[model samples]
Target: MSDNKLWEGSTPFKEKSHLFKYRNWLADNRNIYFNSYEEIWQWSVDNIGDFWESLWDYFNIIAHSPYKSVLETTTMPDFKWFDGARLNYSEHIFRHAQLEQSAIIFGNEQGDYSELSWKDLKKKVASMATYLKSIGVTKGDCVVAFLPNVPEATISFLAVNAIGAIWSSTSPDFGTESVIDRFAQIKPKVFITVDGYFYNGKPHDKTTVANNIASALPTLEKVIVLPYLKKEDVSGFPKDFIDIHTIFKTDGGELVFEPVDFNHPIWVLYSSGTTGLPKAIVHSHGGILLEHLKYMAFHNDVHKGEHYFWYTTTGWMMWNFLQSALLMGATIVLYDGSPTYPDFYKLWAFSENVKINHFGTSAPFLVASMKNKIAPKNNCNLSSIRSISSTGAPLPYEAFEYVYKNIKSDVWLCSMAGGTDVCTAFVGGTPFYAVYPSEIQCRALGVSLYAYNDDGQPVVDDLGEMVIDKPMPSMPIYFWNDPNKERYKASYFEHFPGKWRHGDFIKINSKTNGLVIYGRSDATLNRHGIRIGTSEIYRSINKIDTIEDSLIVNLELEGGNHYMPLFVKMKPTYKLTDTVKNQINGLLKKEYSPRHVPDEIIEVTDIPYTISGKKMEAPVKKILLKMPIEKSINIDSMKNPESIDFFLQFAKQI
Candidate 1:
């Protein structure tokens, strides 16, 4: 609870922040007042219906039909939000089409740049929507995309959602099996994909792969291909395949918004399918719309016409979340290629060129920059960057220090943790709160987030399972193919009966109102009846220059014995030695407790991770615990599937 503050929120910033404006509006209109963010958060969670209702009025949400009630309270998994209302998520995006700034600033690893004006974006979206309707796509029909982080992908998603069709996408980098595993389950009517994509200065031709995926989905009625790699060649594609460019041939004039039920599915986001085929999570049009408006205005503090960018691919939830910036009248910047293609400073340079106000990337990227000693402030003009947000993993204390000491002096560093489950962060930053190292700024308003002990009781200032006591508007309405809602209930609700168990270990600092996320609870290490977070072990390992990546797991043996092992992927030209193992163990013991030290230190060539950048900890633990390889991990879900070969062999010995 000691205040070794990294950055304190200044009065000047608070005065100019969106949250402050909203607070003033509330005070002036509703006669409601609050002295601090904590007080407002308390009021929001305690009166969930009133809090959400206030947001609808505050944002002036455009609903085609009036809702009978704000919230229809039911059991956990069946809670209804804004029933009897109809809205279009895509309609809110084009409300700012008349802005002077371009709607999208796009770049890639190849150093090519492009911009799409609001007028052009709207025209293209309308054309695509018209084309889809012409081909018989309608409300409630599923449309899936196999593309990268490009303007076309954005346009396709908007077009699909505009017609009230459910949308989902996978990055071209995903394996064909992985892509099919997700899209096939949704029974998509239209498959939109890129023929090829560029990454790390290399062109990956996915034309045949796209065709293969198209063939795999028996339910697909149409295929739309953008010939990004070779537009001139038509021989490799099917004669029936529709060219994406042809959609704009007739110039569909006016865009239309299809009004649907408030809780109707807008898109299906898949869970990281490490153990099985991923769960296709369906989120509603109204739910995402309301949640995005609140989070963008209150948490991120992004302003209109300001450039917003997040390093993400079509597969990740961040890609879907990034489009919400348009709802706030912000110009969203999209990058199609690698973040570290030409160099580690690729994104920073892009941010500078685009004048990005809110820069978003994963914690691994920042940690890599810190480890490689690349100072963006020295290499590029980063004056336009206001806030640098990190997700995907916890930003360790050292990474926080590295950003301040090397990247920028006065920049706001915010660390957040949410998952594909909500498509938004439960804990994010607020302009009214001070920044701290190794901790998130605050729990998002209206989110009743808490750390629950083993007995299903909420605990403050202690490591426990992260849970949500109240319903969130953005929570998945249901998982696709989850008939009778059994899969859905088992996924989140069954663990705690009525509350949503978010599968992560977190500790809420009662004094600071900050959150410290450990690694996944399923991958937590237990020794002598004490549970330890893998992040704590990794924080110690990150201090040593020898280790490049690591994974720790605790196995419960047959005879009441516990086997905890640390698997380290060493840096190039470095090997794991006893001296290095001792360094890891000694540092962990000194920094934490003896339980933090692993029983064995082993070297591995690589650590498996999901395509979304999350380490495959639980899957790897399952393998090491003598579970069947096929049942323990799904190879298609891995970023590097072959990397598990070493672990598979190692599992046999254990």
Candidate 2:
């Protein structure tokens, strides 16, 4: 709306855009008129039934039985989608399997690279599926995995889904306690893992951790181990552990997909678990299939034969989202180990080498690259990349500019904001929209999102809680073990009686219709009478060359006074000095407001983040408010668990 477009599309690109094709299809098939993307989006939300039904037809979703209706109810938590339909999640993924097409391309920090053809992928999945069935894994049985972003993990997931069993996984970086806390709740019948994994040029043997997890879960029938790191050294593994090679040794049979109810559980994803035990959020086969089909084919514009890559570990939901690219016939690129291992530009190099069409990563990665002044265009030929997606956290305004100026001038930088609650984005980019700095292009089609004030009324062009007034097919069908639906209700519905409160602070631009996410509403900083999103403060601090990362928290003192301290992780070459503190405070005062300055500026060794790459603000706030550290957060789920020590000491002195 400002006419400050970052990148203009070519005529050919616009003609081939999925949005353009969908608009034409709507006009032709449904006799609907949509003059613009906004009009199409409005129709999608207003006539949710027609939109979803059209999506099923457009995507040509493979199902064993037809649905009686698109949706039976429209209420939150009670919404039923694709009623009377029976399908398997893996069935649709293998529908596009071609003998010569590359299914997965995997790489790691050790310089190991491998590619799996669609033929080989199907064979491996079949073998693994037969092995799982031999071990008594049947429909509705839980199968948990502890592995990296390797091909084996992908194969196991498909195999489990093919058998109609629930599949859940976490990266091997998680400690035993964190894995047990999540997998124990699901009562997995089969456990799959690797003996070890490589991270930051070092080998981490997870044999002990796997044994501990298996020992804790009494329902586990068998443990399958892959010798990923130090293949010859399997001495520490439990006696009952079976080598993964043994399962894949037999002649593979034809793939068999067991059709289950539309609402049958496909995968169980977990909440961040920063506060307490993680919630096991369950998503369904039909729900995930329809959502991913629409998201990848339409929203992302993923086409067959294109290489789609998202840098993620198996622990995060992005891995689940990335794997869906295969369903769309896109070759998925899986990278294990560190994104910054050999250098800060490792992923960029990989993107160029593989000719990735759509490259996705976290906001912090982009911010770090910007601070380091690493220019991908200087060393890598990224001509094949059409779009770069940033998520996990809000992309700072500076980072958005860096991608356009420093990375590539021609590519579309799509910044999205969503969470593990739905395993997909609520607001993201569309090929039809213009790229605006620090703003999500639009609310995803079919998602009725609104910014609600504290009084539960929708607000325009103002910061408020992000809520969904309508039901999404991808919304968690139920929380595992939440029998009476009490936990599920308290999680999303407690804030607004029937609407789903996403708990993120956001604003919708009245003129542009673009969305900007602040930080989590629960972690918003309130000093004196003003409320500030921590992201606003971080955006200002990140401009300093010496500051690598930062987190801020506001705590109320016993005497009704408030203490707002800013914890910063500075570069090794920089020191926390009076001049440096003044620079940071000055930036906040000049860029934001004088009220945005912190009471104290402290240096920290590192910043704690969840394995999924989110700042641990709410948990840190609890610690600063005199809550026990163990009870406040799960250390094992953190990327840098030791970083909490600095905050604990600082909290004690206060």
lDDT of 1 by residue, 41-106 (tens): 998999999899999998888899999998888469889999999989999998878645699999
- Model 2: lDDT equals 0.89
C-alpha local distance difference test of each model = 0.90, 0.89
What is the per-residue lDDT of model 2 for residues 494-587, given as tens digits with 9 covering 90 to 100?
9899999998999998777888899999988877867798889989988999888999989877877998989988998888899989999899
Candidate 2's error at 388, in angstroms? Answer: 0.5
Report how far residue 542 has shifted in candidate 1, in Å: 0.6
Model 1 deviation from the true structure expressed as Cα RMSD, one decimal place: 1.1
